[model samples]
Target chain A: MPELPDPTHETYYSAAVNEALDEELARDPAVVLLGEDIGVYGGAFGVTRGLFQKYGPERLWETPISENSVVGMAVGAATLGLRPVVEIMFMDFIALTLDQILNSAGKLHYMYNGQVTVPMVLRTPGGAKGGYGPSHSQMLTNLLVGIPGIKVVAPATPAAAKALLKSAIRDPNPVVFIENKRLYPRRGPVSGPDFVQPLECAEIAAPGSDLTLIAYSAMVPLALEVKKGFAAEGGADIEVVDLVSLQPLDTDTVFESVRRTGRVLIVEEACRTGGVGAEVAARIAAECLDVLEAPVLRVAAADTPIPSSMDLEKIVLPGIPDIVRGVHELMAW
Target chain B: MEPKPIDLLLDCFRKMLLIRRFEETLSDLFERGALGGTSHFCIGQEACAVGVISAAADTDYIVSNHRGHGHLLARGLDPVRVFGELMGRTIGYCGGRGGSQHMCAMDHSFLGTNGITGGGIPVATGAAFALKYRKESRLVLAFFGDGAANQGTFHESLNIASLWKLPVLYVCENNRYGMSVPVSASTSCLPIAKRAAAYSMRGVTADGMDLLAVRRVAAECIAHVRSGAGPVLLELETYRFCGHSKNDPRVYRSREEEARWAERDCIVLLGKRLREEFGISPDRLESIRTEVDAEVEQAVAEAQAAPSGDDRCALGGVYA
Candidate 1:
């Protein structure tokens, strides 16, 4: 694994997103931010806090509760040589914008014979936290990952969030940048403008020979915690991998790690049935089947609605123990 | 002003004729299994497409719906390329990846036809926002059916366009029926233009059958929108001579209804205006029609002869 470069600054995950938007807005006159309650109210997660005051209403537009139109407007604005970053308050509301996202924005380049590019980022908060109920909390990255066109990036750390978002905004293709609500308050090292992780690659946080534990977004921290506990308690020597870009997946890095470790455990906050973990596991099995000693396993949320209660929510979502258990079981083979 | 110029009238008449002949050709070709997919023909509503599109500047943008062949052609898209797309040829606009409803020519500022009803409204609004943000003089003309006026996106798009005072002309081609349901059945007799008041924007209705009348209203609306007064909702009361698509038998309407709309055909109305008002001889109009037919024939032959788009690299061009 490459040595981790020390970040130049430390800030909250939400602050990192704000910094990325601030940088992009300042850098380009055509870059605009539009969403519901994002202007004076900042944002649902306050990611755009003070941006409206900073950039003013012209660049920072406060829109009505029109999710489909918001996304559609971004798609249109992008075609006209403006980079637009739209926000949907909750990830689940993306369902309302699927026509604009999947059919229009995602297929535009390909369908239009590459005459246009949708240089836009759809930033929305997802994952189970704050007991926001079923409508608000959903790791619906899988819904977008299945799409052929748009890039899907779920940044795990504040540093990654800040960097990937800046990259996503600049990216010519449409990008869906998913943020975890739980990570908003968490503070982490965020680099300056020059430091940005590529939106297409995965990072191996910890190196090990025993097993490869893969996760993204909120699950990455839990996977890292599992790695720390295993090292301290003299369990398996687990390597942690963050599959950042889910669509243009970093399968090469995963295939290399799975080949070395001979075991894999994919984790995700989404449901197990058709979650991104299932895709990662399937890819590993297809490519690393010869080198693998055991079947590729996945630790994902149960195929049920996330309960409102904290106790039920904890059980419904995969935790640190679930990652540790999945790792242990994968190594058992 | 001085008498309407002969050259401009001829151009409008030629555009309407091209659309009418193009749809007529598609109808024959579709019956013989020459074309691949179903197409929505705008046979009688040529005046609406030609009139509004002609009023805009060359740099102005346009968003269209499924029945948008007339709109694209009237905006000066190459008929050969348009036909090539329908024929699934490699040289077609969109590389034949997008057929009739999805054809787009970025250079012409035609944003392509949307498959979903009212899907193009917000996109056109956004384009207008881009123009306004850049302080460009270019405006956007978004064309949809009367069926789309009832969609939530229609209202939401109008609201945003009005709020921002974007340069956009929202045109609703009220062809009376959406697929099978008439506008009267779907909503009240209150015309689609009346809904523009809810967004606090100027709304007007035009005679879709009369080419000169449609152009006059479109000219005024385009001027108002270009001046940044706000977006204008201009509803053109038109009719489609054919079914919603090739497969649609159009059992919903009667022959009497079809004949009534046929009497006020946009092409015939324009032909009378050109001959009676401009005094262009019938021979001259007949020669133009013959020339247009030949042009369409050549386009069809070229599109038919073009190589089939290879799907071996089907996954190519998805990302960039």
Candidate 2:
């Protein structure tokens, strides 16, 4: 393996995503892109800015505003040996594509009995921190978590964003890559182009002994911030675990952390009901009930439509204060 | 029109006859409770399947929908294995995982038939995109019912295929009904082929009952697609003789209409052509019938004796 670059050099999350796409397109001729306004428009979020000019129209094909057919097209192309990475502008718009993504792309391999594989990636921006309102600002990772055939991955940092996307593009099955709009502009150190993060593992963002704080995507950085505040005040040492891969979640790391800390708290930007935190809490209750010091707690967004106003959005979405308060409640319990 | 070679006509006739017999046997089995689950039969639409498939190259790809047994049979897949799939045996095309509506033979380049109405349209368009991107000469043919033309995917996929000029042929088996609701009731357009013109693509309607006519139209459309003139929507005006499925009462249509369609039965028309045009004797036709009946009987017997799919492997192929 080649050595990674120095950690001092940093790049934005969106740039890291662009770098991964550039490298994969150059690496494999079969990796083509299909989406609405992804070509000359440089993508809705600018993640695919220079790719259109670099790869030309044949590689970076623009599509109409048809989400269902675009995804269906990707699944069809993938079966025929092209690794198409489709961009569904916002994660909210994925509702228009559930049939193709869940039924066709997800079930084709099993339905065909392995005669064909749909090697494709659906990259969409999700999460609530953008204040994009009810339709666009949904952290819909919960919707894709329990699906069997499709894999869902959310990256917290620039490095994880780059590495996880590379890994998702290379996976032989359909992978729904959820990118948090809030994390797009955040800068962090990314490894070399050869680095590919494992799709079925969690990373301990920070280590501690007092409590375990589990989060993912945009919530990971917030959890880390809460951990840092506690460290500065010499409060309870909280361990932050980033659940990068939502589907096929790395429960071993979570259970181990819960056992060590004896207290656990799950945080997410998605609604509390039917969120990834609910599944994690249930798993901890089922498997690590004996080791827990208190009930597993969760800090998630309010169970209502995310508002557009900053004040209302702040109250509805989980923030640093909510994580701190949850930790305090867990410690008190 | 000029006649195709006698030998080729004979082969097409045999394939069409086999599909007819296969669907008839399936309908019988379904009625007897010997076969479980629903099956959509292409009893009267055999020529559309055989004619279009025969007009294409062996390497060309095919995407089919629910009423797809005839399509698979015409593409030269084993009847015994297809029967085994319906019988839930491990020797089937999908190892008994996919039922009648969802069987794939990738080695033959026949993608699996979809249960969704217009599900295979965009997939076929995408496959054509892949072939074109790789600079291959092969084209993809997608089959769907007239009801599917009203689906959003049909319109969306046609636009993309036309814009990119993908090498694909969208073959609509306009059997005039979408499971009891007639095309006139569901679709806004007069003929589904006219909807193709909205996408700036070639649209043609063929006489689906006549095997030679369908073959001629399919040949032209296939040649047009293979030559990279973008996708063509070829509507085969056909009808179904039986109920949509085993449980369908088919109260929507009358016996008079059914009899009228039966008069133009594709099998009978091809038999007449073979007797008059090709000089094939009735005794020879009877022998061919006997041969096909025996083949179907052997297939049914072998499929019945085949081992049931193992329950332990139920979750094996969910991922790559």
Candidate 3:
């Protein structure tokens, strides 16, 4: 690993993503951006702001409202030599591009027997935020985590967002960088442009011994908040682990944490059934059953579509209170 | 129109014959249970593949679809390697991973053949974008069926290619039917080439059964694309003599329609042209057929003898 960059200044989550794209576009000529309104409009969430003026139209391509073909185009470009980072605007709309992403992009490398590599990154903002409703807001990370060839990564903080996005761009395989819509405005310390986090590892955000909370993306911060509140009240010393890479998951880190804590809680923003939490809980049951003191619990959104109203949306989505209650229940058990 | 050289005509005829023979062999193998899984053969659409690919430069990229054996052969892939892949041998183009419909020969500038309709259209468009971004002169050629023309990818790719002026040739081999459904039933537009005008691009139709006519139209479209005129949609009006796959009983069409297409068999049409226009002897053509048949036989034997891919290595190549 290269020397880690010292913390320079604080940056917003979306701005950090923009900084990584800017640095990559400047560092490598093969890097290009493609998506609707990504060029002139600077992306739906402004994650690609000012890139159009900096790199011009050739490098920053503004595509029409064609999600399927746009991803297909990125896959094609990646195979040929260009490292295309495609923005699908919202993770919900990735349904339209599933054929290209799953069949074409995800299967091409294996199907071609490694003759081609899709060195591309699909960056999309997901999770219920600002009451975008069921269509615009979704934590569809589960849809991609089960895919074998594709890598799925979600960054919870501004620094990790920058480092992971940069690393995702440099990876040779297809990577789905899931960005939570709600985390965009949050600010955190970011290292210099040279910092790059590994793609297949988990970071221990807060260390404890009484219980462990495994979460990713927006849930990581929520898990940390629960831990902070628990420590302030002199409750159980809960540990928080941020799973940066969801697929090819760092099971070692998770297993190690589970063994030490004995009681574990898996948290996610997706719905309760068939979510990433289920997978984590299953893995823990399989490997750490002997060490576990109590049955593993999960804190996730209710099994329902996100409503447009913030009140209804909060009810459907998991929140800090839910995590707090789940932690208390696990400690009591 | 000035006549093409006799040697070039003869080469095209030989290639079409090879593809015809290859498809026939695959059908025979499937019947005998020698090969598993389904394979889509471009039996009657040989001229379209040969004519369009022959017009392209060796460095140009090609994105083919499910019915792409002729396209791969015309792109200069080794018959033995193609056979090896279809037979599940490790020596295949994709190390036996990608079967008939999914093989890719990157060294030959041939991208993988897609199983989905219009799947390769956007891919070729993207390849063209890459070529243009790097300021390369080479272009990309995408092949899809008539049914694929109605796919959203076709329309989306053409629009992007035209808007960006990407150098690519969109070849729509309109063989009348997309599997069981005929073009007239599935498509709302008459003459799929006309759809190109909506994207502000040039479009043309060619006699896909006639090698010379296809070659002529493809050459013109290739030139237009090579000159950075964006992309062109060349609709090759042709027909498939065989059923959609080997299993179809032709309940959808009459014998008369099948006979009408068989009479215009691209291989036979080219052979007749060679005899009349190029003054080629019938015996010489017979020798070429004999030579190609023997080559196909040899490839099949070699592919059969080659070892199957190891099951343990199946997990490999899933990521770079």
Candidate 4:
């Protein structure tokens, strides 16, 4: 086993991803990396850096940017019993490869009547705030999660990113690993011997009863910040639920918390129209409507496209202010 | 071209004939309104699909485009299930989730074909990468038509395949038309094979009408990758015998042009070559044809008679 790094050490999500590759390669020879620039170039986001040299071109594959092909290849490989992780350059690019993801990889097992399994993970950079504009920025968590066969994991913190990625690779089921570029640098405590979530549970960032703030990926960090502010200003314990997974939602956890707090607020960086927030809100409303002390609320990016300017980008993407207001409004309601 | 053994040649002939009859059967059912939805016939493009698939191991995977029945049947997919799927039966490869355009079969190494052009290219890379990762020597043969070669995924997948030297063989069946539009209208390059130069891979064109030529070229491409030389692009100049699908009247192609290509029917060409050039007896050729016809009929009957899977299975394969 590679020596563990010190607890005080922290790094970017890119670094975490690199570390995951290193660890998994060391752990199992079957885990492979395939995508554009994943080998010699180290991937578009540098997630597969240094891996090509260590694992060689055979293990660390540099593939053509055929998202559909990349995913389809992984599905084929997984059926033959290899654990493959594919990096789909961007979440928005998924639309180009929807058939591969939705039709092939997503439904292989059921389509084959349990004769096969696709043990693969599609690692993709998603959500807005990057200057890439309409072509690149996309919140695909909702799209992937809506599919039945796959689980969509959006890791908000660096620790969660590494742990969730490892779990996704090892899982027998196909998982769409949606990594938020915005939260790549955020740090938090993560225990290991390695980890895998139970697939349908929410991780409680902080416990509280005044209001429940439910969020995932980049929005989780902003929710935590809002929770801290609320604790200091109003002395209220605003529980924060990090929905590490958008699909196979941790509805039980969020509903239980909301039922206790009588107030709830959902946050997302995706556009308000048909964003992941709608699905989360609908779940809460359907399951715990009577138990809520107030109506569930949502704070998300506006319907317009994300601006190129960093300042405007930050303003449009949900932030602590919007989250605080949403929480406060729910608390008062 | 390397001389192929008698058994392999016979298998190739069977596969091509099977595809011809299978599509012919579907054409009849579709025109008769039995099989709804779109059906892109590979009637003329049989050799390219069979040639590529023949060189790959059963476990080695395949990724295909929408007009993929030829590729699917070439890879030895059960005709009945495929027909059942087109007819919206649970017996279909996709369990009715994917109709005519979205057929999938993992057991036969026939990964599902997609509706989008060039959509399965990336997934082919993923499958090959997975195979390499597991130390499985499995390769991926991805089949796309000339129309798909122009999609963004074609550039992305080819570039990646060349850069990484992934074990992939890209077979572009340049049927000279994308629906009603000719290749000249949709593509700027003189030959689709030339596009491989942009990605740093050797590209070559072959006679898609001659089963021997397609087999020879496909084997070479597959051998190049299996030998660790990396991916190669193959452009097979062919034409679909039928309309683009059940609905396409193919107004873009002149009857004269169609006749010119039809003069080189891949299945018929191979049978003649076998009897004339290889010294196979006429009785042997007729026997093979009878066998192919009976096989297609049996598969169609079995698939039609098989019980549609339980409706509760609607959400069955989602998990595994």
Compute the lDDT for candidate 3.
Answer: 0.91
Looking at model 1, the pairs that clash are: none
lDDT for each residue of candidate 1 in B104-197, tens digit (9 for 90 to 100): 9988989888888999898899988999999999999999999998888898899988988999999999999989999899976478889888
Instruction: Name the lDDT value of residue A304 in candidate 1.
Output: 88
- lDDT of model 4 at position A280: 84
> Could you tell me which 10 consecutive residues in candidate 4 chain B have the lowest summed lDDT?
B126-135
Give the per-residue lDDT digits (tens) of candidate 4, residues A1-333: 112244446677768777776888789877877677888788877778888888896677666545666676677678777888888888888886677778777766765556678898888888875576776776766567667788788877767677777778788988888887776655554435365445445688778888888888888778878877877786667888888878788777887888888788888877777757798888888888888888878898887766777677777777777887787677666
Tens-place lDDT per residue, model 3, B1-320, is: 64568878888989998999999999999999989999887899999999988877888999999999999999889999999999989999998899988999999999889998888888889999999999999999999999999999999999999999999999999989989988999999979999999999999988999999998889999999999878899999988878888777879999999898899999998899889888899999999999999999999999999998897557777999
Superior candidate under TM-score, 3 versus 4: 3
lDDT of 1 by residue, A276-327 (tens): 8888888877777889888888888899888888888899899888887788
Give the local distance difference test score of model 1: 0.90
Candidate 3: lDDT of B114? Answer: 93
Per-residue lDDT of model 2, residues B1-320, tens digit only: 64568878888889988998998999889889998899999999999999999999988999999999999999999999999999889989998888898899999999889999899999999999999999999999999999889889999999999999999999999999999999899988878899888999999999999999999999999999999889999999999988888888889999899999999999999999899988999998888888999999899999989998776558687888
Report DockQ per prediction, comma-separated.
Answer: 0.88, 0.86, 0.87, 0.41
- As for model 1, its CA RMSD to the true structure in angstroms is 1.5
Candidate 2 residue runs with Cα over 4 Å from true position: A1-8, B1-4
Candidate 2 lDDT at B129 equals 93
Q: Candidate 1, which CAPRI tier?
A: high
Tell me the tens digit of each residue's lDDT in model 2 across A1-333.
Answer: 123355435799999999999999999999999988888789999999999999999899899999999999999999999999999998999999988988799989998899999999999999876567899898887778767799989988888889999999999999999998999999988877788888988888889999999999999988989999999999999999999989888999999999999999999988899978999999999999898999999999999888988789998998888889899999998
lDDT of each: 0.90, 0.91, 0.91, 0.78
Model 4 ranges off by over 4 Å: A1-19, A34-80, A86-116, A124-144, A180-182, A233-237, B1-11, B51-60, B88-91, B131-138, B278-284
